[model samples]
Target: MADFVEKASEKITKLSDEQLERLLNTVREENKIYDSIIQSIPSGLVIVDNNWCITKINKSAKRYLHFFHLHLIKSDPVWNLIADEEVSNFISFCAQKQNTNTNEEFSIVSADDKARFIVVSILPLVCDGKIAGTIIFIEDITAKRQQEILMHRMESLKSLTNLAASVAHEIKNPLGAISIHIQLLQKSIKKCREGDGQLPDEKFMEKYLSVVNEEIENLNKIVMDFLFAVRPLKVNMTLSEPDSIIEKSINFFMPEFENCGIEVSVNLQGNRNRLLIDEKLFREIFINIVQNAKAAILSSKKSNGKLAINSFIKNDHYILTIADNGCGMDEATCSRIFEPYYTTKADGTGLGLTTVYKIVKEFRGEITVNSELDEGTVFTVQIPVPQKETMLLEE
Candidate 1:
């Protein structure tokens, strides 16, 4: 006891009380700053101790792990807590090779059959020339991957541009001629009625012209879809309110809803909503989703079809729910619902929902669909708002 006291006194006697207090305060401030930086990172971080047990996890880390806020301590193994077999294996392998740090991408699939693409980097934490622990940093690369795919698709389309022009010209030229001929026939029929007391086949002419025009319109839409699929999508983000955007979209489609004998409803849900999104792209998102609902309703031929849009805030995202009482899809169809050129309609361009899915993902958001055959369909859109949920911690 005397030796310990002598050593402690020798270490501290050189510094006055004021200097010791100042040193203690500086250490505390440094620790606070460190914790702030660790939690502020967008990537998920998991810290595992030398015993291969979880020591700490950040808000983002919990999200990627599909594990919400839980007070985990050093005694809990990271692999045991996080139930992904692949993730567990990776962590175990890194623990075995404690001296080596590694970075790898992992594809994690959840119970809902939804796939998440993430990149995991396992870095060994060094302390006093030995491995103290391992730090796992996870980042969502889905948006980056989506952009690469879009760029590839665009590149492929460039090779087909000449053929696109050729096909468009050939298709439109005949349609143009047919339109002109139909107009002339209509005029001729009028003249015949005036020149002689002869009745013309008004019903037959009208029916034939209607069919021709409808077919012409369908062809034009397909051509346009091809052109648009290749066109570069320019996204400019702005701070905007979701309810305002939804209102504008509802106004534009009110006439269609009424004409189609569908009832439309919109609930802003208290209206304190804001998200960082591309205004033009978000408006287009609304238009596509609402139109899809209309199509589903019309196809189902439901006498009491109703469309409802409700907006609210959840977590750190602005949630928009667009639901319809119409023809819904089965599991098989839902699997590839976001794929390009996947459509349920006979005359659909198949790009409407695909466009919506792409834009939502581009803005770091997600689209989820719930439906059953012949019942109804609901689309839930979650767009992240870059706002801190808490001052000291984020989730």
Candidate 2:
């Protein structure tokens, strides 16, 4: 390719004035075509030298920069346009690693004082086996992000509607039982009055009242769980070791695990770095997961059930995984496990995993479940490490 280019250059130099004029016109037309393509792109496009000075920018980029209170000029330092410290720092970091490509999303309050989400991509420009400059692609994703939030709220509203129907059904069963018992007690009292003016049997009264009390307690519990699943959470984030929280959650159920004959194993590798999360909420995540594992094992009716807990750090996120050798779920069941009041267990209120999902979201984390019928199930949770912790780890 290099030799072909050199030969073409030599030939061009030897051309007559008329021929050279035609070649120059053709080249200028090609440059115009290229420039038009750049200007037509919807995403903001910018080209900067190694010193972060803008060499070329497109119309979309110019308009986007104006939102940041920047009036761009050729050869201007691009960093000067960034008013948000966080965004500036990120750009600086990308500049330091210009040889590699970087993609990230950042939130900034624009000059209009409105919060906006932008995706920034930085790629190195290579010429003659040397880094000549960098290409930055900026995209405003605020509208897209808002739509996602709106969709999420709609889904939550749908879940709440389903929960309302489930709650009514759940309450009706206990209420019916209490009403039936009360009618039986009333009949017993009427029989006593008609027979010998004697009172009902003491044991009969205790038995019926006990059932009524138990049903009322169950009703109370259902309401409490429903509230917890739907209400907003107050997360108090503190730097805490995830392994310790995992251990504590496991220990809380150790007796039951032993009695159930489920062999439990834990391998913790994320303890070296601490995560900023609510300790209690984080523990609840594991507790619900572990409890589900135990239930799955019992349902499998296996003589020897194994539960494995593991944690590690990957890609600036702390990952925790729980695997159980139990009767796993089908795809349909797995998908709805996080829905409110959706459960297969005879006595399950079905809000345990829903709470887990909410807490993970509050932490800016993710939870996923993979399962196969009668084989096993694995639940994985990923929580992002704080920026300072990630930088220290990288260093």
Candidate 3:
């Protein structure tokens, strides 16, 4: 009885009623504010004690669990919620590591059963120089991953282009020499056969030589195309008028349109926006898009397919729209059209639009397209206005 009374007296002496009440109220308010902020954030946050026991979860984390068909409960194992074994292993490894928490990437299946990419960061919450708990922050990165893939594709195309240029340069000299020898041999054979009235199987020999010559020509054309695709030409910087550039591109492709029985229309209505563009590259971009449109229109089953090139200045930006009333592309194709070596046209190198995309990006411009199957296709290119001034040549 004496020992129990003594313990009670010590407890009462250590704590003041007002101090205990104030501390409790202050802690409750702080917890409420922390919870409010965590729930407000879009990123999923999970708080766990040192034992890896989930103590607090935000609404976003609950939503993520519902999406992934996982039930979140008190003391739920974080590893059980994670779908990827590698991620689970990583989490365990991080938990074991006393210092230097790491960020890990994981793919989780949502309730819709779609794989969603997320970057998870584990941060240790230290109290009195000892880890008290950990905070796990999950950031949805699906769009970022898609962009990364696109950038990777671009890198691959760049490397391929460089390799193609190297190979073309190496083959050109040998190919030229072989072509010269072939021409000389053909000439010598013709001369000898002409001298000998009875040509020794000249017909068969001529046919054989013709076939060889045709094959060589085809190889040469491929080489030329590769070289053209890979060669990086110096840009001739000039203050170019958008209207003249359009006019020149149209003029350049007029003959092709006539030959293909396709009608070409140009609507240049925008204020003459002066831009610093490499004339040659700009022409190539315009020509490629126009040529593609012409071909598409020509091949369309419709008797009269139309191609239109419209350029206008809008809000300090030069907006150019190229539309073709031809068999248009589906959504899948439009998404991949800018991709290198992706094309629907037969005998297409698949580099035309890619080249256009590259040039537009270099100029800090943007290009986008809209197309519906059998309806038509429209591509919009917005070129920003340059602050620098230069002399503009009139056509």
The numbered model that scores best in lDDT is 2
Count: clashes, candidate 1 = 1
After superposition, which runs of candidate 1 have C-alpha atoms over 4 Å from their true positions? 1-232, 388-395
Clashing pairs in 1: 44-61
Model 1 lDDT tens row, 175-281? 87668768877787788789895756788577657767776876776677566655557865544667787787788879979998999888886654556567889
Ranking by TM-score: 2, 1, 3
| Number of the predicted model whose TM-score against the real structure is largest | 2
Per model, how many backbone clashes are there? 1, 0, 3
Question: For model 3, what is the error of residue 38's alpha carbon versus the real structure, in angstroms, after optimal superposition?
Answer: 64
* Candidate 3 Cα misplacement greater than 4 A, ranges: 1-233, 388-395
Deviation (Å) of 323 in candidate 1: 0.7
Question: What would the per-residue lDDT of candidate 3 be over residues 1-395, giving only the tens digit for each residue?
Answer: 34544454567557689856755566677678878998999988888887776777788765544423245634556766665565566677787664335565555665456666666677777788887888877777767655644574465466775667766676776577667767766776778778975544777567656766765775776676566555554544444676887786677678877777677787897566667566788878788887777777777767777888888777778888999998888989999998656789889978789889878765557899999888888989998765322222321
lDDT, candidate 2, 259-279, per-residue tens:
989999989994556665789
TM-score of candidate 1 relative to the true fold: 0.43
